[model samples]
Target: MMMVFCENSFLSYFPNGHIFQPSDASGVLLFIMTGKVLLNVFLLCVRRQNLHQSFMGYFCISLALLDLVLLVTMSFISHFQNFMLLGIRFTKYHTCLLAQITAFTYGILHYPVFFVAGLDYYFTFTQPLNSAAVCRRWLYTATVAFTWISALCYVLSLPGSAIGLDVNHYNSAYNCPFYISSQTYWFSLGMLMIMCLILILCWSEIVDTVQSVKVITYESETVLFFPYDPECSPRDCAKHLLARLLICFISTWVPFVLLQMLIVLLGAQIPAFIEMNVPWLYFVNSFLIAITYWMRRRHLKVTEETLEADPFVSWKFCLVPFRCQYIDKAQKSTSKIVMC
Candidate 1:
């Protein structure tokens, strides 16, 4: 009687208890719709030659698509399942498979893409000479395709079987439609750790590039390598933008990933309520990616345009938004001192 009562209490908060709350459902739908529109706008604005920018654009678009599909699947499943019927199962075998798979794919696929984005930023600064080749359309396309393919293959290969849902089994509730056995749990955690390490490495390289300055002097040749200001480095200017991106990624994923890790360590002893709602955190990434990237695009465009006008501009450094600082002196020292 106590177990049944506890289960009923938990279910009441969820949409009809088995799905999502009405407010949660509305928010998810809004996120999906807004993401689709913003991602399209982002893609249209991407320059053909910006390989890193192009890669990020395609990755976000894929995320938006995945979110849209997942939303549709959840809505469809909610409609088909009659939660009020006490004797009937709330989630069918096939329905559970579809929902879990869609959610899993959306969450797991981002690990590789994030590593790629971090690498993109790192390499774009480190290899100034190779900027043209780095931004090549073909390379961006290939990298995006490879990452998605690998993530899909890994998720499909995980060991799991569809088991009937039973409230009496706390572990069973955690596994639900498709059972995520220990092997699968560890494998997914391992993948996320690997990507996180790669991101750290990328950031390390970025810091190195920001601290070092290469001086080039030649007669009848002009070049601007980095900001003339001592206090500001390329990385410093970009840190806020990159920080927001990283924060969005961590906030959206850390909760769910941490829960998965805890489950692996503690077995079924982890709190049922924490485990049940954690996956929803993954969906938060979709909305965050959309808003963060949308906000980033305007600043990126201004930086790129400024860089284009100054061939002397160092590829390794971001253009600081201090052009206005030099505006008053432009006429007196325009030729001698180029805008940093």
Candidate 2:
């Protein structure tokens, strides 16, 4: 009697995991749908910015796009095609397997993208990056092609018995995702370990780069290779390096890193509690990737207080609405001025 009164269903997400009755179905669908839409809009914004030419930006966007596909497929498509009723057991195991596999692949694969993103930032800060060019675009495109092909091959290679990723049966006519066999789980887990090692190496190098810069800043008088105007706010450039960077790595990847170790290394079952907490992971990834695009597309507006210090002005400023470019000179100077 007590069990009947409280929620008996095991909800997959936590902080709101208990589902007492069947009426909550609509709410769940709505939640999933909203996440799906945000993800897509974020990706579209990323694509328009052509940060696709930059390896880190491109990879992050790719990761977001892959997650968008996997989540939507899980939310809507998998639900429909994946598990039909067999009195209580679900059917269409193949679809569920494919969806689950793709989701896992995206989850595992984004590790490389994050590593690349961190590396790009580290390189930008520590080493000379070549000017962006047409050939660079081709390289990024080629790399994207290779990653997609490899991931696709991995997904299609799953065995038939692992078709439906069913961890357990659902009550009523339900469609839970399928589960790979223990052997395959270990295999997937191993891939995640390799991903972790790569991220750690990249992060280690980034730290070294930062420490080296710190040493040079205080210990040596070497002029910065690319000088910044001392009068300008350091925050302007530093915002990209410090604040945005922390959000990209710590917020986006740290939860993922812990989960990778938990699920992959320990083979420990992640509490639905932790899994649900990271619901924002996809949203944040989309947001960060979208932010890079936003940064790229943004015009650097030099206000009155800051304009005097700009080393040079871009001619594009002439197109700004109602903005003025004026010349002021003393009467004597004006007479001496020559039009060239």
Candidate 3:
């Protein structure tokens, strides 16, 4: 005799003849697929040397991988019957704990990745000359390490007493094996709020800079370059590139953050329709990232490539908005000294 628990229309079915319907697992499934696609794109980027080519690309790859780790681990626990059975029954405590830690760590890392990326763009646009220090390889490596270490330390410090399996405890609920503490809940929400604030500030400055630039065509190219004022071209292009990056970041995260905050603060149950959709929203960053790269590739195809001598190869990619083909020539001119 299977006992089914119904929470609204969502049901859960247990192996022990205790069946309940919870919200559909489609959201988690969607996340899994999104992660897979993102991973493929990430691998492609690696093969194409895109990730190694720019600091921004490296950060993007790190973010994508972290996102995939979180989604795949969460999905595995949700869909693998044996794993779910063990987790729900508390049969394998250590294994379950490891999974919990892995998921939480990856989820927490999301905020720091955004925090660093936002800072990178903010400084790269607002402080052009000084931004060179910010984009240094050592610094980028340190930032990535800091993100993972901080998240690990924070998760490890949470009280283990509050961590346990709550299997179908509610009349209408999914039997999630990992029970996080209220402290964890508050910490996660706080992180999201902080990240949102940082992005808002960063993008505001970027938009302001972009608006200040008087865009004009140079040599038949709709370049942001101020040919008469060569000093301004690099900065203009920086602003334009950062503006697009900001848009991509915000579009993919704001809705997901709002929904998460609502669910956390109000105890409002997610609507079935939304529950099936929000998980995909979380992974939309990956798609936007790929689209950003594809757009760049398309732009390259449309425009003829011009080679120039620059001490830094990454600078070429960094000046993504303006074709920057003649930037070095402009920099060498007596009128201005432009250094990227």
Candidate 4:
């Protein structure tokens, strides 16, 4: 009789105790979303002040706006717990469902966004946009909008929930239902594996290039220049350029890559909402840029237009040396000072 009475009391206190309570998850999401919002704002300000407006600039600004919207929505959902919206009553479960769907949508967006951004870079580098400034702006705006709209529709149309959240009414504890994104996991794993392979294959060239790389400032812009070596053939220069690019990429993304590795090894299930952030997007941006550069390496030129192509990364630095070497030796010193 005592045990039966104790069980009844427990059920009364925790009506849905068997379900994985999202109170802790909601709290963590709010904290992460707040930090991401601030980070994106700072990045936007920095890009506005120091970088030229390019396709990347537009994409980043749009992403920041999206983050702001999500942050606001999550904040309201967390605070009110339950509310009336559009004449429909929404309980905490509905809010969690909304968040889950949005998070999944955001997770799947990474690939499509990267593909479109890569296309933008390809066209910008291959056939420079000769249209008026207004036309170029419109083109970028349209591209970003299309990518987001398409991704959202595709995710929403999927058959089942990307995340599984179960709510039970019994007073028994259950496991957490955090969603670990397979798409993100595999993408990150593939990148790390490919980077490792490149490191192994080009270890010698990377070492030599690191020793030869020199930094020069021209008109307040820093350019990485490799001194011209008469004995170095065109193929050798290409190898060195690849090495330099690898170094730049690895140095900037070491922390992010390491975190991915740790998660992979431990099989940790990070919530999708928290995984999608400014740093991850920038990491993808850099990867796409590097791939584009590698493909167009033979035709690469360090021109004024190329310098303005990427808002976040100064890829011109990698190509400047090739441009500088073609000039007369007598004018090399002056050209180095003026070209970049």
- Point to the candidate with the largest TM-score: 4
TM-score of 1: 0.38
lDDT of each: 0.40, 0.37, 0.41, 0.62
Question: Which ranges in model 4 have alpha carbons more than 4 Å from their true place?
Answer: 1-23, 48-56, 160-178, 228-230, 322-340
What is the per-residue lDDT of model 2 for residues 119-210, given as tens digits with 9 covering 90 to 100?
Answer: 44333323334656676667777787687678556644433322333424323434423222233234346545544543454454334333
TM-score of 4: 0.76
Angstrom error at residue 135, model 2 = 1.8
RMSD of 1: 13.8
- State residue 233's C-alpha deviation in candidate 3, in Å: 17
Clashing residue pairs, backbone N/CA/C < 3 A, model 1: 11-17, 15-20, 15-21, 223-312, 224-312
| Cα lDDT of model 4 by residue, 135-203, tens digit | 888988988888778867765554442322223311244222333456677778888887888788778
> TM-score for each prediction?
0.38, 0.37, 0.37, 0.76
Q: Which sections of candidate 1 miss by over 4 Å?
A: 1-52, 73-95, 107-111, 128-135, 161-325, 328-340
Encode model 3's per-residue lDDT on 41-149: one tens digit a residue: 5444433222222334455456556545555655565455334353254222223344344444544444355445444433333333333544666776776677668
Mark the regions of model 3 whose C-alpha exceeds 4 Å error after superposition.
1-22, 26-56, 70-79, 83-139, 160-162, 165-340
Task: Tell me how many residue pairs clash in candidate 2.
Answer: 6
